[model samples]
Target: MSLLTTKEIMEIIPHRQPMLLIDTIEELEPGKRGVGKKCVSYNEPYFAGHFPGEPVMPGVLTIEALAQVGAVVILSCPQFKGKTAYFAAINNARFKQKILPGDVVMLEVEMIKQKGPIGIGKATATVDGKVAVSAELTFAIG
Candidate 1:
């Protein structure tokens, strides 16, 4: 079950196909935190050029997916509705596992600190309960 479907998610965040990495919002807390999911497919455009026989999801895109979840969290707030969240910084990112096609990635982001238009969150992406990537992300709401 999903709290927000891809269409619903698009209504909240300004992302389109190819760039909209998350497939669903599994859990949400408005401006505080959220859990998202991505169902990786071999047909993904990047998989074409990323590799021929051995394809791997890009680490930066994983981070971006996490950031989009964070953006959904922030933009869901009544005060910030219809706004955009831009990356300010990404710190201490670690990619531990290769995310392959057909894997379902669980994206989680928890707001750790925020003041005015700037905020920071602790983000992590996992596949089958194994960590694939983790980072601290900072963003500015504008």
Candidate 2:
């Protein structure tokens, strides 16, 4: 069972359809960490042009999905409620494998440092227990 459904997640963050990448949050620790899930589909708009013959989820979008999970982590904090978490920076991002349709991505983000409105999270996205992407994501809550 999911800790936060898509509807519940929408209540905490401002992301909407198409742009809202995470389908559910499996684990949460308010401002400290979160584990989210995204069910990749062939019908996704990006697949139309990302690659016609063989579609693959873009690395940037995967990063965005992970960041959205991070957003949930920070935005769920009582002090930061009703605020948006913007990407201040993304560092040391590494993409290890292709994320294809019909795969379910497990996104995880752990807030490692924070000061005032700025924070950084260690993020990773995996499929079938294999790492697909990993990065250090910096966010600014506003």
Candidate 3:
């Protein structure tokens, strides 16, 4: 019942159309972790230039999508609701597979550490049971 729809995600994060990477949040554990979904479509504006004919999801955008999911998780923390979380770092980023249009990526994020004003987290994106991207991210939240 607490699932976050696109509208709710919009309220929690500043990202919008074309940049808004998350389509839904199926689970949220304040100060702990989260699970989100993004269904890529052929109509995405970036698809055209990402490839001339054989469009492939960019590694950076895939990581960004994962980060956006992490952002939602950070904001869901009871103490941080209504605030913004900024990216501080993303380590060990890896793109193991190519993500194409029409793939529904399942993004999962887990909070690993929260100290002072910074947070450390890990995120991974999977499509069809295969990992497309993964990274450890750190954020400085105000």
Candidate 4:
């Protein structure tokens, strides 16, 4: 029910700079859904060696960001108090575009199901309205 910046997200997820892909979460509905953002930078360490002059965000990183966002949605649920969410699986994941430095990609995730210690979610990454990646991810909370 509120927006969270990386600082707030860090409090919940235990991720930090360099490894923390999400810069801010613009939307949050506890367990139902959430939207997060990642601002790619030209000075990122990866860009220095990602291709010399062409710096494309790694595709796997996008998926990780989405999964982390999805984890936030699940972990933030009131019912999940004192629990930790860990990704267990990923399905039907696809990447369609090249994400570059200076781009602000949006990550959105929707909870599909929650059963006991396991939860499922659908996630998508977009840049300027174009779908860059998507997947169905499952997580476990205990």
Please give, for residues 55-134, the per-residue lDDT of candidate 1 as tens digits.
99999999999999999998999999989999999999999999999999999999999999999999999999999999
Which sections of candidate 2 miss by over 4 Å?
none
lDDT of 3: 0.88
Model 4 residue 90 distance off true place after TM-score fit, in angstroms: 0.9
Q: In candidate 1, where is summed lDDT lowest over 10 consecutive residues?
A: 44-53
| Model 1, runs deviating above 4 Å | none
**Relative to the true structure, how large is the alpha-carbon lDDT of every model?**
0.96, 0.97, 0.88, 0.86
- Candidate 3 lDDT over residue span 63-103, tens digit each: 88888888898887778888888889989999899999999
Taking all chains together, each candidate's TM-score versus the true structure is 0.99, 0.99, 0.95, 0.92
By the lDDT metric, which is better: model 3 or model 4? 3
Tell me which residue pairs clash in candidate 2.
none
For model 4, what is the error of residue 52's alpha carbon versus the real structure, in angstroms, after optimal superposition?
2.2
Give RMSD (Å) of candidate 2 vs. truth: 0.5
Mind giving the per-residue lDDT tens digits that candidate 2 earns over 35-118?
999999999999999999999999999999999999999999999999999999999999999999999999999999999999
